[model samples]
Target: MRYTLLGVFCVFLIFNASQTLAVDTFCQETKTLIVFGNGIMNSEPEADRSKNRLQELLQATLTPDEFKRLEFAIAYNQSYGLLRDLYESLKQKLGADNVVTSFWRWLGGRDILPDAVQQEFLRVAASFDFSTRVGTQDLSIHLALYRSKTLEGKKIVVVSHSQGNFFVNAAYVALHSGTDPLTTNSFGVVSVANPASFVAGSGPYTTLFEDGVIAAIRAATVPGIQPPLIWNLTNILSGARTSDWKGHGFLDEYTAAGSRSVNKILPDVIATMNGLQQPPQTVQDGIITATLTWGAQPDVDLHAYEPNSTHVYYAHLQGISGRLDLDDVTSFGPEHYFVSCSKLETGTYRIGVNYYSGSGPETAQIQILAGSSVRNYTVPLPSARGSSGDQSPIPVASITVTGDTTNGYKFDIVGGL
Candidate 1:
């Protein structure tokens, strides 16, 4: 009889524990979530379209009310306005309406144009208003939306990726000195795969992230101006999908040429569109990190061209969401670029180096950091045949992945052209 009573008590205890350990469901917060996409998102012809695409990316993870609060419609400055001019230029030259369905690579018009035309195109692009280009129009629209009555009283959270984060930084600086009507508004920010570190350099078309999302955090904490929350999910390019959400990864339409069928972003990123919980706080060790170093005198640029044809280089800092972390023009120095195998779409990533300036022959170093292994390669650039200014076609390193990163990733590397 005593044994029967003890068994009943044990069963009761197990049931109680199980009931208390139930999963916590996501709840909707009374705030508005806004997304500031990299170059391409803002360029979408319409706001409703971008908003819907974001919802689809997050549909698997977000509740209906949570989805309703999202607003990709907020107006912000659009970078690559130069691309508009270039598109028109190319449209006129090619006399083809389909100059390129997407502008991710701008193709640098490499395949179509003569060497001199490409040079001219580069010159025009590099000369555009880089100094304050981000702060002017895109940021202005973003601030206006914040101050608008529509978003009043609602918490405002910004999820900025790549170049989008640059606009966020400018907004902080604008609010640093004076007072804005929306000063007390609940504001939060999250920056993913910040290209600011690579772009910040004095090199042409380079941007500065001011060393990661700390810039956003510090900006939020300024006296008289503090957002309710600020979290930076740095370097999430692990070459795999960023979350468990279906259809999540870097870019769904990563194929670089022609019209892309979708604009779905990684679902892990979509979750953080409102808050900081979903993305891991720091970069893990297993991700791939590449460092490129060359003598300071030559304007040697590291170009990592995605299998999709989007090239990551000085001219284009954010290519298919990968980063060119460092670019050196003044000295023989170490420049680094990194992306998680998770963020790397399954394809061949062709890494190459260009002799931008300095006439002499130079040896380039490639350092790959993965798991517990570190491999380094020394590549020599062929002597400049003539007075070639910036277009030296030398391949340095290549990394390819053939399978799903989650199930098990198969990555192969080739070090030379």
Candidate 2:
């Protein structure tokens, strides 16, 4: 009787435990997101369209939850504006075949431009060097990746099209050279209609035969380029007339419904989203962190003045209590600075912004996170190209900390805007 009672009690206990301990089913936040880099947009508005279309497609394809969690952004390369249209006209006059070949050759570091096309090339390009322009643009791209991965702990996947590939490649090199080896794994690329000899970050890329740009490049250059994905031109054109007449458009050919490029690109992006490693969120790793971002404005500088008479800016990156992590010179800046969490300093830290270089006045937003509180300020920066000690940085806010890291830190923020 005693043995039977013991067995019955054990069974009852097991049943009760099973009923009480229901598994927690909270959804994990997605750490991966996508950023679109447009190629050869004629203007800023066109660049906006390219990125918007990609975002729309992703929104339509991904599950509602997935789409919501997968944040998107655009790295808008300054438009060629009228120069692009002029170049197109020149390409027609000089024969697309000759221009494409020479362009790729020049990009490949070849010193010699064929004598026949050299004069025309220089005239049409108007001394506009793609590589040189992209070199500057890469700084903004590098800062974006750093802000996303190293600061926010998010994985970044860049979907680059045409000329954007060059920017991605350059930015990848910069990011790799500066960051930790493990940090590079936080980035990947999906090259679309790529004209570059190689894709950066070793991610999957797709180019189609119907893409006249790639076709012209292939016919003119050597065999280093990836063979285009074969697709029936008649079928594609007949189905939809949305793509560019030359079939080199990002929205019309590559991302459009039933497009071959999308077949490869979507899966590759999803795989990368799953495969990339997630780093710990370090945005708040410091006791006081200030991040400044602006619109199409080229250069916006972030400055942090510590109470100890130490100033941290682009010129002086490190201070006694904090350091400037990134300084952006190209369009759409995210100049970032932070006070070390370990080296908590109890004093007044002034946060300042400077409209270093831009076309006109720009609205700047700075978010300062300190002691579990975040304060955001939006201030219109005048069109003034301020350098080190030449023009005073516009004071945004001041934070006064009162305690050490041992017990807990207290923050008193004073607005200066």
Candidate 3:
């Protein structure tokens, strides 16, 4: 009787342990957020640091209950030559029980080549297994994992930076086509400095080149795979030429174009995730117009023109100032010209002029025209007499237009220095 009782007790213990495991293994209403780095994912130190910082930021943004229900996944070191390491690390962090963290490598077998060589290699390699494995194959694997019993029914958020975004887009396409199992669930994607280029133009992936990728991401329609909501965050300090490989590995070293603040970017990301905001949209159809003028200057003959010869003037428009070309404007005139009221779409704009003098004070009247309206402005030419003679170029500025969309107005002209 004693031996039988002991055996029964052992069985009871085993049953209880299995039950506990089962409980921990299932999360019915959990949300999964996958944060990915581009090239940095391959660098251990950078990846770990970025992950820690992002986690802290997320903690601050999410409520206690929401945070608890959220599962975080970071993919690093997988795109380079470190595919296996990236896979193992994600598995360990997510656990063999309840989570599915997809690990993909877009730049796998070609890691041995230098940057210059890889560029050429990727063009041809796009057809090879190495490219297929990381780019499309790995994504397929991830889909299968997501469809497995362990991860079914969970909400997924894919946060990828740089090249990783490319992989995400490809995965999205594959899933939409019913080529992958995990594509059956709804997923949200947040892409930062996504190398896809359509976000800002000019990158490893040109804007035109990435349009197809965007279309692919948009095509996803699996029952389980939620239509992806893509959020693109561009670096305002760095111009559009930044490399995905470089930016992901050295974020601190590079700044975003247009001087966008980093602190603001994170908050914007959180707000977007919480459904509190939408990405900024282009306010105006493509159109830009500006006016030029010179106030009265002390009459000096053609000789006077010589004194002011060193002085130069130009206009600059910030933000979406339309497709107006600088060369078009520069090629047109008697050096100075006037633009009549022409329709301009809503966006940011600015204008300015410079002055120089051989010795006398001169002034000129300036008028700016955009979309059937003229804003009169003035700038005084300084006398060559004082230190003010060397004043740098003055930037005339204006308020950003918000909702104007009338089109095809002519820019009429006036004046020269």
Candidate 4:
């Protein structure tokens, strides 16, 4: 009887181990990704140089496992460049089976011009052959290629720089807006330094344009399909204006100008994708909390880096005096920001605040009426301001709070409590 029991136990353990392995394999298998290169992908005189640079950059940013799952597609500008050379280079790096290179010789041959200047060229070129236009035709061809038997059951990721964003946007509109949803063309889009204005009320296809292309890409979602999370990286150091249409045309110019380092940008791209794969967090309370520890200073003043800047700047500028006041607390410590609700609920919430220093140990009190009692805490600031009459008190840094409600509650702060 003892011998028989041992055998059964061994069998059960083996079965359970196999089940765990199977789950892991399924997750790894589902991570299929494709990378698309923009016009500059092949601009280098030597195909090998361009291909190797891109491959090395990708290798550094992605894990070996992630690198294995990625495929590359190079879109070559037709006129002065040789599409065949670019294709050959990409094929060598990504393997012929995994790379798809598309070239429009007539369009690529035309003189490089600004978007407005190239309008006539685009009309002439797009009219010639449906497959010639990179935005519409080329994208359709690529989608078809993606759906081919070789790529079945694979997830899609489009990485486009500069003008490539335009082409991909056009393709997204074409595939998504119509009556018949192009389920086969499902994929996430990553726009690097794209300058296109995403403002609403811009044009006719604006709704479709924003929804299918920019917004969907950002959220990583498509209608009737799981949204592929999208990432956009803008470089502040590159000196390239994020809004300039001309600046986007030449990738080399932007890179040379130092808008952002390639090292910094590439890592972020890979990290964003990895983050999406992690299981999402569930918020039990309407409240969400974040804490920042002060190292060098006990008190720090938070302010908008620039006056009249949009809300987005609140996160961008570091070490600026922008005051984020919670209720009446005029000055608070630098370490903690919190949001609380009367009851627990399921929803999303955001907390924004600016920390400033006036005097004493830099303490603040926060009260949420939903729950009983006020929460008191000391936030460390860097150091006290020098005793000078000329120096101004720290400016107001803004903090924004957004969340769904399980119950309604009012929030206020008592500064220097």
Candidate 5:
């Protein structure tokens, strides 16, 4: 069975092998990439709640034109509320001192939990496919954002909250390590209620002195973990209150209009977008985009067979209309594809992958953004020597476009891959 982990975002763009997607030279010269990395949430409802709040804040803050120029996405990481409740129960049963000690140990890079507790944690972790799962999912999501439509010619400002800071930081490192120096200038990060010592992407992180979680982490003096800079009285006065009891809610204490964090974030985002050199080319595709990222194994290929029987892949970079913007023959790919907005066709387009060659088994992830809908598929390529033909590659998904270029195309996920 094939399952999906959702990496939500609005739109991403990509150029050629440089791994940068672009917009047509004639499109908006500059656009904003507001990729939100949400904090720990028991459920998606809590996660989405913050995104909605942030959206509201952005809508209210930016001018009508500014808001329209924005592309938003949520890099959601799973947090089990039940596990938190379980830990509390365990704390009560085993004594808070022991639970706290075990937690600090885990934080300090050791897992010395009692066997029963460790087993439970591992069981739950497996159920969610945490380590092997979340790591790749986060990569795909942010890479999608990196190649998103907003990033075509401008920088991307990641506004990450709480645990999201950790994810964003890791992603920033991974992307920077892989891309060119110019790509580095195309990315920025803003951290809030951060618990990590280091900020990613030239960060000026935001954390309240009154924030209990960060305070506790700081009190522990965990070697590598430190609280973000303390906010001054003037800043605190504007954001002392919070919707979350912890004073860490993304909206209530951080991004709400006039809050110090928002004051810091908005200007930083604007500065990032404004302080960069444009890419060599820019092309907009509000129509469709598919991004592929895989594991350590090398030479995974992304194929997009267009409705007009045009096949786009490593062998052939451009089809009748779609373009394979990035092709990676080495390990850990982010091969991308998209149909130019101006030449969208009306018919079914199939997406597939081939484990062209590799050291060992690899898991391939493909994220598709068609119109406003985003879908993610994870296919485990157990072996190598895969062939490329109309049906040789393992099918991932299919997208059907209705309407026409004259009226604007409507993209829909037709059915199973």
Candidate 6:
């Protein structure tokens, strides 16, 4: 009896020691990478499967070096949340087939005035319960960060998409609200296709997120020492982008084929992940990307006119092959345009710029990329002092895709991002 008791005590000590060692190991990392999944994606068994799948997707697709750096944890599972509730409610009311369709159509701000059928669906989606879910998601993400008590002072970065953006912002507010931004440098958030108005808007899909959501995201734009960059990669313009299927799809990321699929969204993820440390390695998505940065200009716009004579500026956002991924006016400029060359008609694609606001002749550093070819253009973007409408754009450079290579299109651009 004495021997058995002593053995049990020894085992208990070993278990506790192992657990402590595990936590210490986790804390060794300088920062934490947390991924917030999509709606209907964060439930028990599904969440576990999705988490594993997400990790596997990243591991499989990301370069071996990138995969090595991909140390992430699941912050929240939304399987049983308010969005799920809305889904279930919609399913019952309009049947499963129409739920996603109606929601998406309404979401993209289409066909609302003529069809009264979707109004009820919108009402249901924007109900009180969804608001409660956002609150719950906020706390849930906060808990994920706080639970790692061993890593108390480590910087936290949240990778969120779609509705997850709202949750992540709420979590940021919860975590860093009363604290000193300069001191803790608490955390940074990366949001994709945030809808920007999810929690705030009403009426239609385009105006879906009203006041509250807008205020929250606008607040997020305020530059912090830790960098509060909101990565809003909108349309993919190719024949049904990976996300266009669900509209909000390809929006969480790291997945192989879902809306925020790794292939479609991985490039941006690569840029953001390597943003803090070593230089980023671009993802090979067969698309030409131009990212503009002018420290002096707060609101400069990027425009890409295709060989097909279609323009993709802020006004005509969607084109034959590419889309204006983001139009940043409120903060430092990183206005971008991504072109899936598969849809290109084979000619010189004209790249232009508009010095939208805050005075220019601003030295704009433009980075253009296609496959392995990257070039940097330093141009003096002329100044414009007026309303948002008069964007007097100037044609800056061009990318000529002579022909096709094995990897979609063999192309060379005038500039790098």
Best by lDDT: 2
* Per-candidate RMSD, Å: 26.6, 16.6, 28.0, 24.2, 11.0, 25.2
Evaluated at residue 341, the lDDT of candidate 1 is 36
Ranking by lDDT: 2, 5, 6, 1, 3, 4
For 305-378, candidate 4 gives per-residue lDDT tens digits of 21233221223332122222212222222223223222222222222223333444442222221122222233
List ranges where model 6 is wrong by over 4 Å: 1-31, 40-54, 61-66, 77-123, 128-141, 144-155, 179-186, 197-245, 251-264, 277-417
Candidate 2: tens digits of C-alpha lDDT, residues 147-224 = 644566778888888777777878778777743344547878888877676788777877766666566555544355
* lDDT of predicted model 4: 0.34
Model 2 has an lDDT value of 0.64
Higher-lDDT candidate of 3 and 6: 6
Candidate 1, run of 10 with poorest lDDT:
1-10
| Model 3: per-residue Cα lDDT over 1-417, one tens digit each | 011221111112133332322111111123444344444234455555555555666677677666654545454424544444434444554553422322233232222323433333233212222223456544533443222211223444555554565566665565456422333335445555443423211112211122222333334333454333343333534445433342233244122222232344455446434542222211211122332323233221110011112222223222221322221122111122211112233333444444433445554333343332344444565653323422444454442443311211232223331
Per-residue lDDT over 132-221 for candidate 6, one digit per residue giving the tens place of the 0 to 100 score: 456743353244333221122333445554455556656655654432122344355555445333321111121111222322334444
- Tens digit of per-residue lDDT, candidate 1, span 190-227: 44434343221111121122222233333434355332
The alpha-carbon lDDT assigned to residue 118 of candidate 4 equals: 34
**CA lDDT of 120 in candidate 4?**
30
Model 6 scores a C-alpha lDDT of: 0.47
lDDT of 3: 0.36
TM-score of 2: 0.53
Q: Estimate each model's TM-score.
A: 0.35, 0.53, 0.34, 0.32, 0.68, 0.38
Error of 6 at 39 (Å): 3.3
Deviation (Å) of 390 in candidate 3: 91
Tell me the TM-score of model 6: 0.38
Q: Per-model C-alpha lDDT, please?
A: 0.45, 0.64, 0.36, 0.34, 0.63, 0.47
Q: Which stretches of candidate 4 lie over 4 Å from their true place?
A: 1-31, 40-52, 77-135, 149-151, 177-186, 199-264, 275-417
Which model is ahead, 1 or 3, in terms of TM-score? 1
